[model samples]
Target: MSTIILVIGYAISCTKNDQVIIPDAGASSTTLVSVNTSTPPTIDGSIDALWNSATKISITPTVPDPGNGLFTGYIGEQYAGTLRSMYDAQNIYFLLEVTDASQSTNVTPWYFDPTANVAGKTGWAKEPSSKTYDVNGNLIRAAWGEDKFAMLWNIDNSTPKFAAQTCYASCHVFTPYLDYSGVLASPQTATTPPTVSNSGSGNHYTNGPNEKIDMWWGRLGYITKDASLNLMDDNYQDYAGGQAITNLTGGNANGRHVDGIVPDGTKSTIWPYRPNYTVSPTQGEVGNTQNLKLDGTGASVAVPLWVIPNAGSANFILVSDTTSGKAKKVTAVSSAGVLTLSDGSTINPTVGTDYQRTGDAVNGPTAKNSIPANIAVPLIGGRADITCAATYTGTGWIIEYKRALKTGDVLKQDIDFSSLQDQVFGVAFWNKSNNQHGIQPNLTLTFKK
Candidate 1:
């Protein structure tokens, strides 16, 4: 975070204490719609009775804050987004939709620079690629960074006018601990910087250096961080830039911990989650229920091997030769024998992106085809308190997140949603894997019975 930039201007807080990020864009201030439904909305991103009728708040692009020196806004009016909010008596929900042209999940866990002889290096340009340099930086140097989203909630509404001036209260260029080698860079220091000089930058909470802001980070790395499970990470931004307290099942703080170059990296670190066709029978390809077309231009012909797990979940990954080890998630697992990949393509693992690995009788860590898919121990606690699901409809992605209104587990970093008071929150979206994100600050979610 030590990317020093000369601050050309400074921003003064002028927004009202009651401001809402998406107010009357045509819709009224009833942005937080409460629905007391006994039937929980399916965590599947589809427009259902659970969330379809809820008010859809249009999210416009957030212009760059010239006053903020770390300003890096890549979304230049290119994409627009929408959001939906709903809550039952026990939980709060948010569905965010963002327009993205492509999906990029090449996080540090999944990045492989084989020619340069590094196994789990990052996507940065410093990595050797036989002929060129891996330039995404030791921490990050990839144009196609991981796809992600985040939600920021004002803790205890402590900052004055947090309900209205949500994020602005904390944007004072306060850096969190990102030092990979410094002895002082412990997780505790990473969560709350020990001093003003070593904090690094970008954390703007000035009044109270220890002021906590609830931040939910949905990095694509987490989705496949585990070979068999799906996850989204949770962290908070305070004195330190951003720190995640826990990882999802099968998730880790840093995928490249084997080498300590990026030791400070969090689970949100840019890494890829390669596919493991051998883990379960129905894991990668389920008998090629539908036939797919292949590129047919490879030097060596590719093969597809259908596998089934011991007790596989309803989820499946789409392995394709064209996309290297990129695995797309296929939710519909019809037992009828015919497989429909996430794309409208058939299940015959011979299509452009319909490829699979085949080495051992079953695909696991030892499977020849999936030799690189290192299966590590999942995260502790798994942060089950926060659950989210998303579906991408061609132009954009629709995401749904659900969490209990009360925090009980100290391990999960759960929120204390106990009282009926209103809370302040902010949302951000990543488009097509760019490092820059579109952010909306100071959103209010009023909890009422």
Candidate 2:
């Protein structure tokens, strides 16, 4: 905290060097909010009147690090946030909003196949670790990333002083750490030492085994909409809790690290996963949403994005499928996405024009920013405990989280709200795309009966 001060002389037109002084930064505050029983608001990521009635708590930095050689992702101030929370008899809901400059939607996704230099077929990249050098091998680890928000709750009051210390209770500053990059390869000895590639010291687990910290990890883009897929990674920080493991018997929900897709390498056989993420409904291209339609013959053409099942649902007709030679009506059901029948059956469209209306022209659907339900990419985790519905409203992101107040199975690592006491929770943010996250801690939410 340095400051430059200008010195003044009375008569001699003073010739003196400017003095420098340093001052301490202003104090930071903790956020605390109380909640009353209320109806569950629609989990649409919009600021509705329901949330307006609840107490608002600002989530800012507690302790941040300049990061250990992992590029220049400093913490303590960048991606600050505010949140509102309330619970009903059945479910607990959270609405978190953040101020982010940009979004990183590309996880390990299928890009131009380097081998074939083609689109669509080439396997996806395992991680977004592309680096550029100045013709010198100087490592330019520029950060490019997707937006993510996480909340770690110390359930059962097991963690000592977690609420006061927040995530710092476990986030240790281990020395001689290495960053996780897709391109970099550390030499492996005959013993295969524990490298930063396998285990990192900076962001490693800080909790104890089986102690249980409920981690509600939410992600945006990579295939889904702003903040759709919300999964709870059941975690208890263990110095030995490694993210990279071969047998993912418990799945990624246990914080196991699965390999990302790489060209001409071992591929994953997980179904419904688009390379690295769980498939999601909103992962479709937002520009052109496609629906289902029948031609005069038995064939189908890519029409428009499906309408959800409801009174407002859409119905399209094609005379080719009807014996009356009249346009038969196809009604949209509750299930949306993909050009498909109301019954959720496949109605294949003509190859070229039907496959997203052939390249450049937006000749497909009526909605400008819509995604066909069927074709949209999805999250790899399927559905998670904490589910969200979020969309970027031009400025920042408005996300909604919904989960059962009590998951009943505490053994499965669910956050137990059955007792309804003030529990310790910490939050983190990732801003400006890439892996750079903002570290903040200790926002308490107390619920009243």
Steric collisions counted per model: 50, 30
Top TM-score: which candidate number?
Answer: 2
Please list the Cα RMSD from the true structure of every candidate, rounded to 1 decimal place: 14.8, 15.3
Model 1 Cα lDDT, one tens digit per residue, 1-449: 00000001122111122121322223234256454556667666566766766776665544333232232434232345667766767777767777776654432211112232222221111111111123542322324344567666666654554565555554433222234333333443344443323321232332443455555666543443333333344444343221232111121221101100111333333222211111111221123222222222212211222322211211223343214434332323222222344454434322221122223212111111111121222222423346766665655566667877775544223356667566766655554332344455645666435
Residue 345's lDDT in candidate 2: 56
| TM-scores for the candidates | 0.51, 0.53
Question: Which lDDT values do the candidates have, in the order given?
Answer: 0.39, 0.41
Error (Å) of candidate 2 at residue 357 is 22
Clashes of 1: 50
